[model samples]
Every structure is written in C-alpha cells, then in structure tokens.
Target: MTRIEQTFITLKQQNKKALIPYIMAGDPNPSVTVDLMHKLVAHGADIIEVGLPFSDPMADGQVIATAGERALAGGTSTRQAIEMVKQFRQTDQNTPVLVMGYLNPIEIIGYENFANLCSEAGVDGILMVDLPPNEADDFPKKLQHYTPCPMNQIFLLSPTTAFDRRQSVIDNASGFIYYVSVKGVTGSNALDTDDVSTHLKAIKANTDIPVCVGFGIRDGVSAKALSAVADGVIVGSELVRHFGDDSIDTKTAIDNILAKMDELRRAIDG
Candidate 1:
C-alpha cells in the first residue's frame, strides 16, 4: 500500500483521526523547510502537506497567499519543493508527505518529468487545487507509472460542488478526499459543524475512502468538532500564519505552530 493508504489504515485500526498540517516550503527561507517538517511530525502531524510556491494561488486566503509570496521570494521553485520532501524522507519514511500546489509549475516541468521527480523524492501524494478530476487524464497515469507504490491524486470536494462533480472527484481520488468545510477560501471564518456533519454524511454514504475536512478549522474546539465527522482534519492557514513573521525568529514561529498543533492533536485524541 501507499504510505497514505497505510496511514489511514493504521489510524482506522486505532480509532484515531489523522492530523494533517500544511506548510509552505521555504516560507521564511529554504534552509528551514525540512527542519520545520521534522518538527511538525514531532509535534503530532500525521501527514504533512508541503505547498509549492506559485505566482498566483487562487484558492488560498491572504494568510497562505502571503506565505507563498515569502516562499517565492526565498527562491523556492517546484523542483526545490520536491527536494525538500527528499530531504524530509531521509529520516521520516513513515509519515506521508503530500505536495500541494497549482498545476502551472507541473505543466512547465512536464507531467512525466514531474512524476519521475516526485517518485524519486518519495512523495506519497499530490493535491493540485486547480486540476479537476475530469480534466486530469494522463497525469494520474504518469504518476502511477513512475512511482514504486501508486502515487495518490488527492482531490477536493467543496459544499458548492454539484453531485455529479462530487461523484467524479470521489471516483478519482485515492489518498483521501479533502472536503472543504466552508464555502469560502482557505482561511474564512464561516464554519458550521452541523452543516459540515450533514454534508459529510452524504459523502461517506457514497465511498469508503477516508474523507478529511479542511479550511476554517483554527483551533482545538473547531478541530474537535470536525474530527467527530471526518477521518482527518487539515489545518492550513491557521498553521501557516504562525510562520513567516518578521518580528519573531524562525524558532519562535515553529514553536507557535507546534503549540497550536499540540492543541489540535489533544483535542482530536480526546
């Protein structure tokens, strides 16, 4: 099984929900990305979603968009992001590392070449925000062909998604389904747990694949609320906001991020 599949299996057996944290590669600088990744695992991250810096990130909110800007300014490219994963794999062979980004960089690198690089870097999965399942024809095939284990193509399903589109995403998704909890962008504050629970019920009824909720989850209370219905909780903007602070040192930034992660982990495990 892929590392992602194995992780979900183990979590299911233990009756525990996954805690996935998102970090932009080279947020403050390229040197700290891998170390920050290891620190995230130490603090209680099950899966780490490393964001590849893009010129334009349409789905991200101001917090994450600013992070991407910092990353790009530090000279982090798509290849460099993959290299960070490779460095992270030196010690962390178990925790699944997913590369989350837009599709333009991959297009520039070419699908086959990007697949090969990801496979070599030991990337477990990929989440391209703009690539719909219907439009992704040969990319998934290339990933599967290049990797020793099948690389998962994680897809997003939002509340606004039509039934047919949701079905298509569910059918194509492998690692897990990223159920966007809110209708707005990544850091929007409009989270309603009751509505999330209702939508999750409809989604889980259709597929056995694990569904992880993301967006609008900020702290222990919200994480706890979402964990009741989701197989996993993904914290992005809430976590990324802790990094890239000019006033504080990188160590302090990571400490803040880990403190938040610890709270989320405790709440999820409770």
Candidate 2:
C-alpha cells in the first residue's frame, strides 16, 4: 500500500485523526525545506504537503500566494522541490509526503518524466489544483507505470461542485478527498462547522476512502471541530503565514510554525 493509505489505516486503528500540515518548498530559501519538513514531522504532522512554487496559484489566498512568490524568487523549481522530498526521505520513511502544485510545471517537464521524478523522490502523492479528474484520464496510468507502489492522485471537492462532478472526482481519487470547508480560496475566514458537517455526511456515505478538510481552518478550535467529522485535518494558510514574517529569523519563524502545529495537534487529539 502507499504510505498515505497506510497512514490512514494506522490512524483509523488508533482511533485518531490525521494532522496534515503544508509548507511551501523553498520559501525563504531552498536549503531550509528539508529541515522544515523534519521539524513538521516531529511536531505531530501525519502527512506533509509540500507546495511547488508557481507563478500563478489561483486556488491559494494572499498568504499562500505570497509564499509562492518568495519561493519562486529564491529560484525554487519543480526539480528543486522534488529533490527536497528526496532529502527528506533519507530520514523520514514513514510520514507521507505529497507535492501540491499547479499543472504547468508538470506539463513543461512532460507527465511521464514528472511521474518518474516523483517516484524516484519517494513522493507519496500529487495534488494538481487545476487538473480535473475528467481531464486527467491518463495521468494515473503514467504514475502507475513509473511507481512501484500506488501513487495517490489526490483531488479536491468544494461546496460549489455539482453532484456529477463530485462523483467523478471521488471515483478517480486514490489517497484521500480534500474537501474545501469554505466556498472561497485558502485562508479565507468564517468557517461554518454545521455546514461542513452536513456536506461531509453526504460525502462519507458514498466512499470509504478518508476525507480531509482544508481551507478556513486556522486554529485548534476549528481543527478539533472538523476532526469530529473528517478523517483528517489539513492546515495551510495559517501555518504558512507564520513562515512569511520577514522580520523574524528563520529559527524563530519555524518555532512559531511548530507552536501553531502543536496547538492544532493537541486540540485534534483531545
């Protein structure tokens, strides 16, 4: 089984929800990505989603978009992000590492080549925000051809998604379904837990695959509330915001990020 699948299965057995944290690879600099990933794992992150820097990230809010800009300015590329994952794999063989990004860079490198790179780098999953399941008929085949184990082709579902499209996404999804808790971009505020719970009921009725909620989750309260309904909680913008404060030193910035992670972990576990 893929690392992601194993993780969820293990968590289920433990009666615990997964805490998935996101970090922009090469944010501030390329050298810190691997270290930051390790720190995140140490701080109770079950899965790590590493953002590949892109010039245009439509789904991201201002916080994450600015992070991408910082990473791109530091000369971070798709290859660099993949290499960081390879470095991270040297010590962390258990925690699943997923690369989240747009499809432009993959297209530039060719899908087959990208699949090979991710497989060799020990990447567990890929979440291309713009690639719909209907349009990606051959992408999973390419990943399976290169990867010895199954590589998760993660997909997103939002409140605005039509039933037909939601079904198609769930049918094609492999690792887990990323349910956008709000109808806006990442980091937007005002999460309605009741609405999220209602939607999650409909989704869980259809599939046994783990469903993770993201977007608009900022703290332990929100994370804990969502954990009641979701198999996992994904925190991106709030965590990423801690990393982008230029005034703070890298060590201090990372400490702040881990502090936030710790808060979320405690709340979820409770």
Candidate 3:
C-alpha cells in the first residue's frame, strides 16, 4: 500500500480521522520550511500539503496569495521545495508530504524529470490544482517510469462536479481525492455542515479510497463536522493566516499554528 493509504488505514484502526494541513513551502522564509513541517507532524497533522509557490495561484485566496508572493520574493524555487521535503525526510520517514501547486512549473521541469527528482527527494504525493484528469492522460504512466513511483497524483472534485466527472476523478486519482467543500477559492465564508454531509455521502458512495474535504474549513467546529462525514480535512487559509503575521517570529508563528492544530486534532478525534 502507499504511505498515504497506510496512514489512513492506521487512522481508521484508531477510530480517528486524518487532519491534513496546507502551507506554502517558503512562506515567511525558506530557511524555516523544514522546521515548520516537523512542527506540523509533532502537533497532529496526519499529512502535510505543501504549496509549491507558483506565480499565480488561482485557487488560493488573499492570505495564501500573499504567502506565495512572500515565498517567491524570497527566491523559493520548485527545486528548493523538493529539497525541503528531502530535509524533512531526514528525521521523518512516515508522515506523508504532498506538494500542491499549478501545472506550469511541472511542465517547465518536464514531468518525468520532476517525478525522478521527487523520488530522490522522498516526496509522497502531488496535487496540481489546474491539471484536470482530461489533460493528465499520461501523468500516471509517466510517473511509473520511475522504478518505484514516489508520489500519488491527487485530484480535486468540487460540489458542482457532475456524477460522471466525479467517477472519472475517483477512478484516476490515487492516494485520496480532495473534495473542495465550497464552490469558490480557499478561505471563503463559513461552511454549511448539512450541505457538506450530503456531498460527502455521494462522494463516498463512488470511491473506496479516503475522501478529504477542503476550502472554507476554518475552525475546530467546522473541522469536526466535516471529519465526521469525510475521511480527512485539508485546512489551508486558517493555518496560513498565522504565518502571514510579520509581527511574530517564525517559531512563534509555528507554535501558534501547532496550538490551532491541536484544537483540530482533538476535534477530529472526538
């Protein structure tokens, strides 16, 4: 089984749901990225979704957009993002780290070469927000060229997705499928629990793999409500908000983030 699959299985055995958090790789500063990753695992994150800091992140809101701008201004590159994962793997061999971003960078590096580099760097999964399954016809085949495919090519599904399109994504997606709870960008308004539950029911009916819900999930209450219905919750803007405060140091930011994560961890486990 993939590391992500094993992580979910282990969580299922414990009667606990996964709490996956997202952060831009070089936000605040590139030097602190690996340390922040360790802190996430230390707190309670089951999987860490690290953003690749693209020039334009269409799916992200202002908070994340600002974080990406900070990262880029600090000279963060795709290679450095992979190296962060390599450094993270030094002490952590189990926690799954999924790199998320747009497709332009992947194409620039050449997909096969990028896969090889990720394999060498010990990355566990990747989520290209803009690369729908239709355009990624050969993505998995290319990834297989590596002796042992080092990453799961995760895909996104939204509330408006038709049944057939949902089925298409579920069939093609590995690791777990990311369900965008809201129809908009990250860090939007409050989530409607009843509406999300209905969507979760439909998605779970179609796929055996874990389905993680993201977008508009902000606090422990919302996290708990969603976790009760879905296999996991991927929180981005709420966590990224802490990192954007220039008034605080990176360690202070991470400590605060972990405290928030602790709340989420408790909520999901409850």
Candidate 4:
C-alpha cells in the first residue's frame, strides 16, 4: 500500500483522525522549506501537502497566491521543491508527503519523468488541482512505469459535484478524497459544519475510501468539527498565515506555525 493509504488505515485502527497541513514550497524563503516540513511532522501532521510554486493558480486565494509568488521569486523550481522533499525524508520516513499544485510544471518535465522524480524524492502522492480524472487517462500508465507500488492519484470533490462525476472521481481516485468544504477559492470563505456534515454523509455513502475536508478549515474549532465526520482535516491558509510577513523572524514564525499545528492536533484528537 502507498504511505497515504497506510496512514489512513492506521488512523482508522487507532480511532484517530489525520491532520494534513498545506504550505507553499520556498514560501517566505527557499532555505526554510525542508526545516518547516520537518517541523510539520514534529508537530503532529499526519501528512504534509507541499505546494509547488506556480505563476498562475486559479484555485488559490490571495494568501496562497502570494506564498507561491514568493517561492517563485526566490528561485524555487519544481526540482528544487522535490529536493526539499528528499531532504525531509532524511529524518522523516513515515509521514506521507503529497505534492499539491498545478499541472504545468509537471508537464514541462514530462509526466513519466515527473513521476520518477517524485519517487526518487520519496513523495507518496500528488493532487494536481487543474487535472480532472477523465482527462488523466494516460497518467496512471506513465506513473506505473516509475512507481511499481501504489501511489495516490488524489482527486478533489466539491459540493457541486454531480452524482456521475462523483462516481468517476471515486472510481479513479486512490488514497483519500479531498472535499472542498466551501464553494470558493482557498481562504475565501468560512465553513458551515451542518452543511459540511450533510455533504460528507452523502460522500461517505458512495465510497469506502477516506474523505478529507479542506479549503475553509482554519482553526481548532473548525478542524475538530470537520474531523468528527471526515477522516482528516486540511488546514491551508491559517497555517500559512503563521509564517507571517518577512519582518517576522524565521524562528518565531516557525514556532507560531508549530504551535498552531499542535493546537489543531489536540482539537482533532480530543
């Protein structure tokens, strides 16, 4: 099984939910990516979603958009992002690492080559925001060439997903499914737990695969409420905000980030 798959299974066994945190690669600066990644694992992150710096990110809100821009401006390339993951693997061999970003950079390197690079970098999965399951027919074949073992081809499910499309996603998807809790871009809105629970119930009825809620989960209260229904909660903007502005010392920023992670962790596990 892939590390992601194993993680969910293990969490299920322990009756504990997963805490997945998202951060932009090279954000704030390129020098801190690896250290921050390690810090994430240290602070109870079950899985880490590392965003590849992209020039154009349609689904991202201003917060994540700015983070990506910072990474790009700092000379963080796709290769450099993968290198950060490789360095992270030196100490962390268990926590699953997922690359979350647009497809442009991966296509530039060729699909097969990108899969190989991810494997070499110890990455366990990918969530390409713009790539739909139907359009990714050839990707699995290419991925198999490099990854003989299972690797998550994670997909997104939103409130607007039709029955057929939802089935298609569940049929094609591996690992846990990412359910966007809100209709808008990341960091643009707040979550309604009742609505989230209703939607999550419908999704759980369709597939046995674990469901994870993201995009509007920003704090302990929201994370805990969502985790009661879903297998995991993904915190993006809120965690990214902990890094603060350039003026904040890197050490202080990191401490704040870890403190937030620990807070969310306790909420989920409580």
Candidate 5:
C-alpha cells in the first residue's frame, strides 16, 4: 500500500486521529522552514502538508494567501519547494509528506517533472485545491510517469456538498478525503464541532477511505471533537500565526500546538 494509505491504516489500528500540521515552505527562510518541519514532527505532526507558493491562491484565506505571497517574494518556487522535500526526505522517509498548493506553479514546473520530483523526494501525496476529481483522469495519467510507488492525489469536500457529488468525490478520493468543516479558509473562525461531526459521520458511513476534517481548527478541544467522527484533523492558520509572531517563542508555539492537538488526540481515543 502507498504510505498515505498505510498511515490511515496505522491510525485506525492505533485508534488515534492524525494531527496534520501545515507549513508553507521557505517561509521566512528555508532553514527556518526546515527547522519548523522537524519540530512539528518531533511534537506530534502525524502528516506534514507542505504548501507550495502561488501568485494567486483562490481557495486560501488571508493567512495562507499572505503566506504564499511572502514565500514567493522570498524566492520560494515550485522547484525550491521540491528541493526542500528532498532535504526533508534525507532524514524522514517514513512520515508522509503531502504537497498542497495551486496548479499554476505545478504547470510551470510541468506535471510529470513535479510528480517525479515529489516521488523521488519521498512525498506520499498531492493536494491541489484547484484540481477537481472530474478532470483528475488527466492528472492521474500524467502523474504515473513519475513516482517510485503510487502517489495519492487527495481531494476536499465541503459541507454544502450534495450526496451525489460527495459520493463521486469520495469515490475518486485516494489517500484521504479533506473534509472542510466550514465554508471558509483554514482558520479565522471557531469550528462548530457538532456540524463537523454530523458532516464527517455521514461521509465516513458512505466510504471506507479515511476522512480528515480541517478549517478553523485551533486547539485540542476542536481536534478532539472532530476526532470522534473523523479519522484525522488538519490545522493550518493555527500554525501560520506562529510565523508572524516574532516575539513568541517558536518552541513554545510549537509546544503549545502540540499540546493542544495532543490533548484532543488523546481525548478522542482515550
């Protein structure tokens, strides 16, 4: 099985909800970006989502969009992000690394080359927000030319999703289904756990593939709530806010997030 698939299996076996922490590559600088990754993994980041910078990220909110802008301004490129993955692969070939970003940068690098690089760099999956499942046959075909093993192309589903559409998306969803808890960006609001649970439970009952809920997940309480219904939880703005705070101890920030997520993770399965 692919690593992404294996990760879910392991998570299921352990009765633990995955803690996915997102980091925009080369934000601030490559070294810090790299350091932050290691720290996150050391803490409790079950899966690492490395975002590639794009000029215009429509699916993103102000935090992530601004993060992409900053990374791009700092010379972060599609190629550079892949290189960071390579660096990360040097030590961590086991933890699944997923590249999440816009399609324009991937187009610039060429799909096959980018996919090949990711496979070579030990990336386990891809999550292009703009790419829909209906047109994924082309990408799935083109992506075949590259990875050493199969690479899962993950997709997202929102609450407004209809049964037929959700079924189709779930049918096509590999690795895992990124179920958005709310209709907005990754952060900027408090997640209504009841709504998240109702949505995730329905999706879970419909498919065998694992479901991971994201957006507006800030603390362990939120993660714990989502965990009761979903297999995992993704945190984005919670992590990005750390990058902007120059005064807060980054180690502290990392620990705080770790503690919060860990608390929720434990509460779910404990």
Candidate 6:
C-alpha cells in the first residue's frame, strides 16, 4: 500500500482520527519549511500537505494566498517543493506527503516532468484544488502516477450532490477523499457538526475509503469535532497565521499554534 493508504489504515485500526497539517513550502524560509514539517510530524501529523507556491491561488483565503505569494517570492518553485519531499522522504517515509497547489506552477514545470519528479520524491498523492475531474482530459494523463483526489464541498445552494458523482470522485482519488466541510473557500468559520455529520455519513455510505475534512478548522475543539466523525482533519490557514513573519512575536505565535495542534491530535488519538 502507498504511504497515504497505510497511514489511514493504521489510524483506523487504532480507532483514531488522522491529523493532517498544511504549510506553504519555502514560507518564512525554504529551510524553515522542512524544519516545521518534521516538527509537525514529531508532534502528531500523519499527513503533510506541502503547499507548492503559486502566483495566483483561487480557492485559498487571504492568509494562504499571502503565504503562497511569499513562497513564490522566496523562489519556492515546483522543483524546490519536490526536493523538499525528497528530503522529507529520506527521514520519515511513513508520513504521506501530498502536494497541494494551483495548476499554474505545474503547468510551467511541464506535467510529465512534474509527475515523474513527484513519484521520484515519494509523494503519495496530490489535491489540485482548481483541477476538476470533468476537465480531467487536460492533465489527468500527465498526473497518472500521482494520484488525484477531488475535494467534496457540501453546500446549501447546490442542496446536495448525488451518490454516483461522489463515487466517481472517490474512484479517481487513489490515496483518499478530501471532504471540504463547507461551501465557501478556505479560512471560514467553524462548521456545524450536524451539517458535517449528515454530509460525511452520506459519503461514508458510498465508499470504504478514508474521508478527511478540511477548511475553517481553527483549534483543538474544531479539530476534535471533525476527528470524532470523519477519518481525519486538515488544518492550513490557521497554521499559516501561526508563522507570522510580519509580527514581532512570530516564534512564540508558531510555537503556540504548534503546541495546540499537537494537543488536539492527542485528544483525538488518546
């Protein structure tokens, strides 16, 4: 099994939820990104979503957009990010690393080269936020080696999506399913557990694959809530806010968020 698949199975057997954390590559600094990655894993992150720096990020909020821009400015190209995965693999091959980003960077790098590079780096899978399966004709072939998982957005205006559609998405996703808990973009408010439960349980009814919920997950309470229902939880923007380069209290802020995330993972696992 793939690293991503094994991690989820391990958590499932333990009767615990997975804690996945995302941080933009080359943010704060290129060197610091890897350091923070290991620190997070040491703390309790089962899956690490390495944000590949992009020029324009649509699905992201202001916080992540800024982080991406900074990483781009720091010269965090697709190659650099992939190298980070290679370095990460050298030490901890157990934790799955998923490259999360826009299509522009990979487009510039050439999809064939990007996929080969990711496979060589031991990357488990990818979650291209803007790349939908309907439009899979354009890039799916190029990313064949790198498994793609569609993010499921539970919304009100759309009412709900049919099972056939979600099952198709799950089939496309080789690693696992990314269940977007809310309708809007990232960095929103806390999701109501009832809304999340209804939607996720519906998803669970369709497939046996692991489901990881993301977006607007702020603290221990929020993480614990999502973990209680879903197979796992993903935190990104909140972690970005922790690495505040502009703030005088950057180190302390990062330490605080890291500590809380660790504690939250313990709460879920223990």
Instruction: Give one clash count per candidate, in the order shown.
Output: 0, 0, 0, 0, 0, 0
Q: Give per-residue CA lDDT, model 2, range 46-110, as digits (tens).
A: 99999999999999999999999999999999999999999998888889999999989999998
Better of 1 and 6 by lDDT: 1
Give the per-residue Cα lDDT of candidate 5 at 165: 77
What C-alpha lDDT do the candidate models reach, one value each?
Answer: 0.91, 0.91, 0.87, 0.88, 0.79, 0.74
Cand. 5 TM to true fold: 0.91
Q: Given candidate 1, what's the lDDT at residue 196?
A: 96
Tens-place lDDT per residue, model 3, 109-219, is: 988788888878878787898888877887854553454535688989998888788888988888899999988899988578889899889888877889999999888
What does candidate 5's lDDT look like per residue over 1-270, in tens digits? 678889889988876878888888877566667767776788777889999988888877888788787788889988889789888878887888889987887887887777888888778889998888886776754453455756888888998888787887987877899998888776759578888888877888878998988889877677777777888888888777766667876566556656665565566555
Of the candidates numbered 4 and 5, which has the greater lDDT value? 4
Quote the positional error of residue 75 for candidate 2 in Å: 0.8
Ranking by lDDT: 2, 1, 4, 3, 5, 6
Judging by TM-score, tell me the better candidate of 2 and 5. Answer: 2
- The superposed Cα distance between candidate 4 and the true structure at residue 121, in angstroms, equals 0.8
Candidate 1 local lDDT, residue 55: 84
TM-score attained by model 1: 0.97
Model 6 reaches what TM-score against the true structure?
0.88
Better of 2 and 5 by lDDT: 2
Q: Give me the runs in candidate 5 sitting further than 4 Å from their true place.
A: 141-146, 246-270
Clashing pairs in 4: none
Q: Could you estimate the TM-score for every candidate?
A: 0.97, 0.97, 0.96, 0.96, 0.91, 0.88
Off by over 4 Å in 4: 141-145, 148-150, 244-247
Question: Model 3: how far is 117 from its true place, Å?
Answer: 1.0
Query: In model 2, where do residues sit more than 4 Å from their true spots?
Result: 141-145
Better of 3 and 6 by TM-score: 3
